[model samples]
Every structure is written in structure tokens, then in C-alpha cells.
Target: MNLTIQFYTMLSMIGMGAWVGAALDTYHRFLQRPRRKRWIVFLHDIFFWTVQALIVFYVLLRVNEAELRFYVFIALLCGFAAYQSLLKKLYTACLEAIIQFCVRTYQFFAMLIRNLLIKPIIYLAQALLALFLFLLHMLKIIFLGIYKVLFKLLWMLWKLLFIPLGFLGHLLWKLVPQRAKIFIARYAGFLKQITKVKGIILKWWNAIRTRLGGPRE
Candidate 1:
């Protein structure tokens, strides 16, 4: 029974060493080697060795009641040598392939989600923007049409008023005294100046409206 326990203990240590070797190889391939910072690499090395030492110590305690033996150390070295010589290449290749497959799968799903969800949302936003612009253009055309009709009516009313005013001015010019005539002339000049100012104000107003994306005259 004592000999059997010793053999089993050796086998367990050997298996543990093989597993540790594989874990170290995987860590080096994926995490340790790609690091650019010396401090980060050092921290990782320290953490890896610490965790491995704790696991070996636990195994030794469980198997041999925490007794230190030369043969136990030898068994661990032999197992690590076996893994390096026989299994290292195959295990590393399989681990790399598995990692690549997972990365490809994640990228594929991400692209699929972008196409199904994000692309459609962008297209919908563009369509809404186009529709809004079209509606704004139609509103501008309607407002311009109303402005044109109102301007035409006002112009016609001004012409109708001018006809009677012209006749009255002619009669007053013939009948009025010189002083009265001079007063009427001054009043007519003032009216002309007022009309000029009105024209200037209308021009400025139209320019402002046009700049604001409203209809132009």
C-alpha cells in the first residue's frame, strides 16, 4: 500500500506538470509575448509563477502530507520534459486555431448586426431628412404664391387711387393761387420721398427673407 501510494503520487505530480506546461505555453502564445511594456511582462511572469507554485504546493500537500522528497521533484521535471518534447507543437497549434475561430465568429456576428440594425437606421434617417426638405420647399412655394397675389392686388389698388389723385392735382394746379400752388408742390415732393423710402424698406425686407431661405421676389 505504501508503494502504491508513492506511485500514484508520482503519476499525479507528472500529470500536474504536463498541465502546467500547457498552460504556460498558452499564456506565452496569447498574452505574454504580445505585451510591449516591460513592467507589464514582469507582472504577468510573477503572477503566472505564483499561481503555478501555489498549485504545485497544494498538490504536494494533498499527495504526500507536505513531505519534501527528491523523487517528487524528479517526477515533475520528467513530466514537463515529456510535454515539451511530445505535445507542445500539437497543443499550441490547436489552441491557436480555436482562438482564431472564436475571433472570426465574433467579427461575423458584429458585421451581421451592423447590417441588420445600424444600416437600416441610417437609411431611415436619410429618408426622413429628404421628406422634410421636400415639405419645406412646398411650403415656400405656397407662401411665395400668396405674396405675389397680394402684391398684385395692392398694385392694382394703388393704380386706381392714382387715377383720381392725378385728376385732382391737375384741377388744383389750374385753380390754386401761387402760394397755395407752392405749398401743394412741397407736399407732393414729401410724398415722393416717402414712396422712395418705402421702396428701399421693401427691398431690404425681401433680401432678408431670401437669405432666410424664404421665397425671393
Candidate 2:
């Protein structure tokens, strides 16, 4: 409307145009269009253009009440042209350098954490596990050795007593009445028969349960 407003609007549009160019470069740099699906690229393009348009319109609203005169377009084009000719190469180079720095920083921190924290913890855990296994193995061997020694001593003691005890029992049995021996032998046979009958019944029950697909105790 007035000279001051018009001048301000032109300057704002020029700055907006340069900003848009820079934003476009950044977007495309990250978008990786060749790797993106068609639908995704399409959506991203629509959103990007919409946002840029809205930004330009909002700037215009602030500068000159959203007025659209012919000079605004000329000024925007000039600013974009100036960025392309003068600033594109410098900005791109700086951006690449910054990206490399960031990647190096991330890699350094990751390596530091792995070496300082993770590796030591893993080694300590492995050491504890190894020590535990070693102690368990030693305990097993010690118990087994003690068991073997006890078994041998008990076997020797039993052998040392058995012959004399057996001879004494034979002499005592000879002194016993024949009728009493006969009664004990018959009762022992009866008990053996009962045990055999129990075993057979249990076998039959287990077989029946198996055939019926029932769980066994």
C-alpha cells in the first residue's frame, strides 16, 4: 500500500525465497528420493510444497497484510537465483562437513561405551560363571571320593564280621528245633508269593492305564 510497506514486503519475500531454497536443499538431501517408494515421495513432495506456500503466505500477512503485487514475485525469484549462484556450493560443503563430524562423534561414543562398560561386564560375568563351575566340579569330585572310600571301608568291615557271624548262626540253627525252622520257611515262602502277586497286579494296572491313555503315577 505505502512505500515503506512495499519495501518491507519485498525484503521479506527475498529472505523467504532464500530460506525456501535452503530448506529445499536440506529436504532433498535427507529424503533419499531414489530409495523412497513412489507413494512416499509423492506425499512428501505435497507436504513440503504446502508448508513452503503457507510460510510464504504467513510472511506476506505479517509484512503487508497478505498483499500480492507483481514486485513480490520478482523479488522472490531474484533471491532464489542469488542463492543458487552464490550460496549453494558453500552451504552444501558445510553441511557435509557437519554430517561427517556428527557421524564420527557418534561412533566414538559408542566405541567408548562398549569398551568401558559392556566388555568388562561380560568378562566379569564369564569369570564368575567359570569359578562357579570349577567349585561345583571340585565338590562333586570330593563327594564321590569320600563315598568310594566309605563304601570300601564298610565292605571290608562287613567281610570281617560276616564269616564268624555266619558260622555262629549255623551252630545256633542246629541247636534250634526242626519244627520252628519249618514254620519260618513256610511263612517266608508265603510272603514271597504275596510280593509276586502284588507285582503282577501293579503291572496289569499300569498296562490298563497305558491302553486307556491315562497318566501314570
Candidates in order: C-alpha RMSD to true structure? 4.7, 8.6
Deviation in Å, model 2, residue 33 alpha carbon: 0.8
What is the per-residue lDDT of model 2 for residues 1-217, given as tens digits with 9 covering 90 to 100? 9899999998999888888888889899889999999999999999999999999999999999998999999989988888898999998888888889999999999999999999999999999999999999999999977976675576468668978998999999899898999887879978899989989987886675565454453
Error at 194, model 1, angstroms: 7.0
181-217, model 1: which lDDT tens digit per residue?
7876779978899999989987996786665555555
lDDT of 1: 0.85
Best by TM-score: 2
| Candidate 1 residue pairs in backbone clash | none
Q: How well does each candidate superpose onto the true structure, as a TM-score? A: 0.75, 0.77
lDDT of 1 at 155: 56
lDDT of each prediction vs. the true structure?
Answer: 0.85, 0.88
Clashing pairs in 2: none
- Predicted candidate 1, C-alpha RMSD: 4.7
Largest lDDT belongs to which candidate? 2
